[model samples]
Target: MTERTAAALRVVNAPWLRPLIFLLLIVVMWDLTIRIFKIPPYQIPAPKDVVITLWQEGPMLLREAWPTTVATIWGFLLSAAFGIPIAMMIAGSRTIESYVYPLLVFSQSIPKIAIAPLFVVWFGFGMLPKVLSAFLLGFFPVVVSAVQGFKSVEPDMMDLARSMEANRWQIFRMVSLPHAMPSIFAGLKVSITLAVVGAVVGEFVGSNYGIGFVLQRSIGNFELPTMFAALVVLALIGVVLFWILDVIERLAIPWHASQRQDVFLAA
Candidate 1:
């Protein structure tokens, strides 16, 4: 094998090593920056202190994080349930597109945090508001991506399907739907991360639970290490969620062009 092939094999076989090394490098740099500048812990706790905090408070953090994780997943599922059908509806007809598309675009322009309070008012101080926040953040991307995916089917393929006496539903099922998987998956990857952010924003605004609430409390109390630790857990949640989606995408659409490129890059 060529050197490129060997390097690709290493990455494929030892997937965790490179990321771990990078994490260690970041921790080292973070520690060095604080030490070199004599920065105080209250402003930016050292990595050692952060690590200690993480160990000390891991159980409590995990308990707080559970609600946020649930809200994130529930919101993501709701967005997917609504977004795909709405996208198909919009894509299926010009009348529907003209009526709904502009409103969707307008909603996207508004900052999520600005409208989060309204959701709280409508849904009250419950998980519903957080779920709605996550849904609002996640919904638009799926609609856009699914529409693109549906419309991306080649003209020649459509003609072939028509010639073969395929109905609209049949054509969509066999060609358009498959063609759209990669794009849908792409939207889902983005939406999931945004869902996490949405949940945190909701928690920050009004909740008495979640890692985000813990973070806010830490900030108020000036517990820099606890704040840093909460942030670390939040980061891990996002990374793990994104990775899970990526894995699912690869498994679901292994024949997609992007997946083929990924395989080529890997080996």
Candidate 2:
């Protein structure tokens, strides 16, 4: 291959490079849009201005980020911890599934954002409201995904385990749980991102600190660049959390078929 073609081939083979390039391209487009439209910085600051805002406000931003991060993590863990067990109860007993599953589905239909203000009113302006708001937002997906995962075990595999005289717990531990892991992690990745949003919603309703609170304060003072900077931090939080989960999923289930799909990318 020619030198240019060989270099292109190498970039294609490295998984992260393409996305990095795409991100740069979008930034360029964003800058151009502002310049072409003569958009005032007060309305939408340039990327460079945002970078400067981040640099100037970095420490304060980090300080505020901790509360939201804690809330998100706690809410996500709460959903996962409670969701898996509830899912087990649902999958293990058809009667309970019939009664409880509908209620779960109906609960998800309610607008979670509407409930944020109520949480604040009840819990005051503390972390509890934020964590509960996030839990309410993220709980459904975890339960649904966990239930699907638990029920997804093939009958034949279950039968083979039973035929081998494996006790119910043994069969579930060795076969069912492992089989459900990929799905459970899938749900977790989605739930964590949602939890971040939910936590921010709570902060928006009422909070003394957090990246979300920063956004609210910036808006009142008309510090658009600072507001944008806060948004960037929030985005980074979600991206970082998602990436961590992705790594965990790979480590936890390396043998999964989706994890083994590198051959297609390499090709």
Candidate 3:
């Protein structure tokens, strides 16, 4: 490769650099749009304006950002904590699967946004509602993916384990669980994004703090730049959280076929 091509290849290989380039492209496009269209600041503020607004309101945003992040994390953890056991039960037993499968499908069919008001009424404007909302939004993917992963275990491998006289738990731990890692990670990525939405929905219903609360307030006040700044912060937090999980997946499942595929594609 030429020197410039080699440098571009190195950047594409580096995960952090890729995001930095993305952000730069976004800002450049944003600036160009504003300049070309003479877009009013109230409609779509320039990146520099949003940056200055962020600087001015850094402390406020940070304070609000914490509660949203906390709620999102707790809700995500709850989903994983509850989802895995239920998924395991369904995966392991036909009776359990038959009993809960319809209910699970029905739950997902409902419009979660429409139910936000009822959640507020029932839970009464607190962290509980927010966390529960987040959990509800994020939990199904985990359960569904987990079940699929467990079910996807190769019959040949299961037969081999049986022939070796492996116990049920051993079969699960050595065969099913490892095979399920990629699906679990996939579910987690979806869950984290949903978790952020859940938190914001909860805030929209009722909240004194959180990025969602600030965002709502900004919208009401016509503070477009500040609104954009809050959104940028929310996006950054989500990206960071997702990146951390991606790193963990890489470290934990380095030998998985999916990981190998990702490496091959990257190459």
Candidate 4:
């Protein structure tokens, strides 16, 4: 290829630029296909229609989005709070791992959607149920990742710390935690995204105030544009939350290989 063409390809393929370019390409394809086929809006609204609906209903969508956002945050925080400690315990004790690991797997085997109605019945269509649903969905990944992180610390490192007269707490705080942070952050990112789904599931089962509710209302009325707009809002929420976690991870673990590699790539 010519040098100019190769340079253009490199610019387009930059890590941050590529996804945006691909998304734009997808939207263009979507619009073209719809125009060529003369598809009915009811089946799938054009991207422009979805964008217009988002603009017109921005305030209402924002209002509904708040509850889901709140629930997702609460659930994710709770998951991290409880999950990390539990993982630490499991990592510290083979007994605890033996007893609890099977139960965790069993719980995950049961579909959250199937038991969502149970939460609604017990919590009565309130924020609590939604938060609980989010918690359940987001909890597992955090615990699993944390346990792996903690367990991955080399025994020799612990021995060296102990030989230097370090107590258990000091060893954990200085050695295990720093080493485990990257893995823990990985889990947190996954957990946060799942928490969003959990909140929506809770709303789907029984709640009047979330983007999920807006979606349901729009579907009932056959308002495809509004439904698509709700979906767009949901996607934005997940993307924003995940991006926030990624930023935090980079800030918190800049010394780690992953963060260093990201910097190298960006540079």
Candidate 5:
């Protein structure tokens, strides 16, 4: 390999160096912008101020963040649990797809926030409503991705499998499902992020617990720093969730094109 290629690989795989550098750059730019614009702390706190806020509010946020995280995780799991079967049915039968696809599209088109109150009324203000909202947020992507993935199986591969006298289940398990793993994972990653948003939205409407509830209360009390701290916690939750999904994807489908180190190197 060329020296230049080696250097690039070294830099990319160093991990901490790049992230640290990026973070430092962001902090410098943020500090500079805040200083130049003289933006008030109430309006937009500086990185340093936010850090202080995080430290000050850590104990309270710790108490609130757990319930929200739990809700997000459960909602995402439920979405996957229900969505995968529906997607499989749709992919396996054109009749089902024709009947259900439009409904899926219509449901997606409807603004979720508009219907959140309805969910609260139907399911009540307990964890059920929040989980349902999150499930709604995560539902579409899994189905869509699974359908596409199943349909994307190469015809030649299917023909080869058929020649081997593979049964329908065998064809799906060996060919279609494996081929679609990347797509399924793509949808899963997107759903994980949406799950956090859904949980927060659920809390926003009416809830006695969760980070979103704390955030609402902070805003009501005009506690800017606390709000900022809550936001940071939300962001951290999202990052952690995404990372966990990424790890799972790697474990589940290490052979997928998306997991290809060569692709990463080329990019």
Candidate 6:
């Protein structure tokens, strides 16, 4: 390649630039496909139409989005609060692991969508149901990853801590917790995104608020542009929440090998 062309290719391939470039390419291809095939707007709105709808209805969308955002955050926080302790208990004892782990797995096997209506019925279409749904979806990942992290702690390190006269709490706080942070953060990141999905699922089942409701309404009315716009909002919510967890992970575990690799890439 020519020197200037090679420089442009390297810039586009950069870690930070790659996603935006890919998104732009997708949008371009979408617009081209629509034009070439003469697709009906009602069947599939053009990208520009979706963008226009998003801009025109931005305020209303944001207002509806607030409830979903709140539900997602609350649900994720609840998952982390309960999941970590449960994981620790399970990791600390074989009996607890044998009994609780199976139950946890069984709970996940039940489809969230199948039971979502029950939450609405029991909780009365309130934020509680949404929060509960999010909790249910986000909880398993945290517990599983945390259990793995805690169990992965080296026996040698524990022996060293005991040799130094460190108590259980001190050893856990200083050694186990630090070693498990990367895995915990990985689970948190997954949980946060799933929480967003759970929140939307809750809204889909029963709420009168949130982007989910907007999507349902747009679908019923066959407002394809509005439907696409709501979908875009949902995608943005998931992306932003995931990105926040990633930032927090990097900050919280700067010494982690993964984070060190990220630093190397950025440099």
RMSD of each predicted structure: 3.2, 2.1, 2.4, 2.8, 3.3, 2.4
Lowest summed lDDT over 10 consecutive residues: which window, candidate 5?
12-21
Per-model lDDT = 0.89, 0.90, 0.88, 0.94, 0.89, 0.92
Give me the runs in candidate 1 sitting further than 4 Å from their true place.
1-13, 261-267
The reply for model 6, stretches above 4 Å from the true place, is 1-14, 261-263
lDDT of 4: 0.94
lDDT tens string, model 5, 38-153? 99877777788778889988998989999899999999999899888898999999999999999999989998888888888887889988888888999999999988988888
Relative to the unseen true structure, what is the C-alpha lDDT of residue 132 in candidate 3, on a scale of 0 to 100?
Answer: 84
Candidate 2 lDDT, 1-267, residue by residue in tens = 599999989878687787788889998998999999999988888999888999999999999999999999989989898888888899889999999999989988889888889987898999999999888887888888888999999999999999999998998899989988888888888899999999999899989899889999999998988999999899999999989999999899999987887864656
The true-versus-predicted C-alpha distance at residue 65 of model 1, in Å, is 0.6
Q: Which of candidates 2 and 4 reaches a greater TM-score?
A: 2
Regions of model 4 farther than 4 Å from truth: 1-15, 261-263
Q: State residue 69's C-alpha deviation in candidate 3, in Å.
A: 0.4
Residue pairs clashing, model 2: none
Query: What TM-score fits each model?
Result: 0.92, 0.92, 0.91, 0.92, 0.91, 0.92
Maximum-lDDT candidate: 4
Displacement of residue 185 (Cα, Å) in model 6 is 0.5
lDDT of 6 by residue, 65-182 (tens): 9999999999999999999999999988999999999988988999998999999889898899999999999999999999999999889989999999999999889998888888
Candidate 3 lDDT over 1-267, as tens digits, reads 599999989778786687688989988998999999999888998899899999999999988989998888888999889988888899999999999988999999997878887888998978988888888898999999989988998899999999999999999988998888888888888898898888888888878789999999999999998999999889978888888888899899999776797676777
lDDT tens digits by residue: candidate 1, 180-202: 88888888888899998889888
- lDDT tens digits, residues 1-267, model 4? 699999999998788898898899999999999999999999999999999999999999999999999999999999999999999999989999999988998999999999999998898989999999999999999999999999999989999999999998999999999999988999999999999999999999999889989999899999999999999999889999999999999899999887798678777
After the best TM-score superposition of candidate 3, give how far the Cα of residue 78 lies from its true spot, in angstroms: 0.7
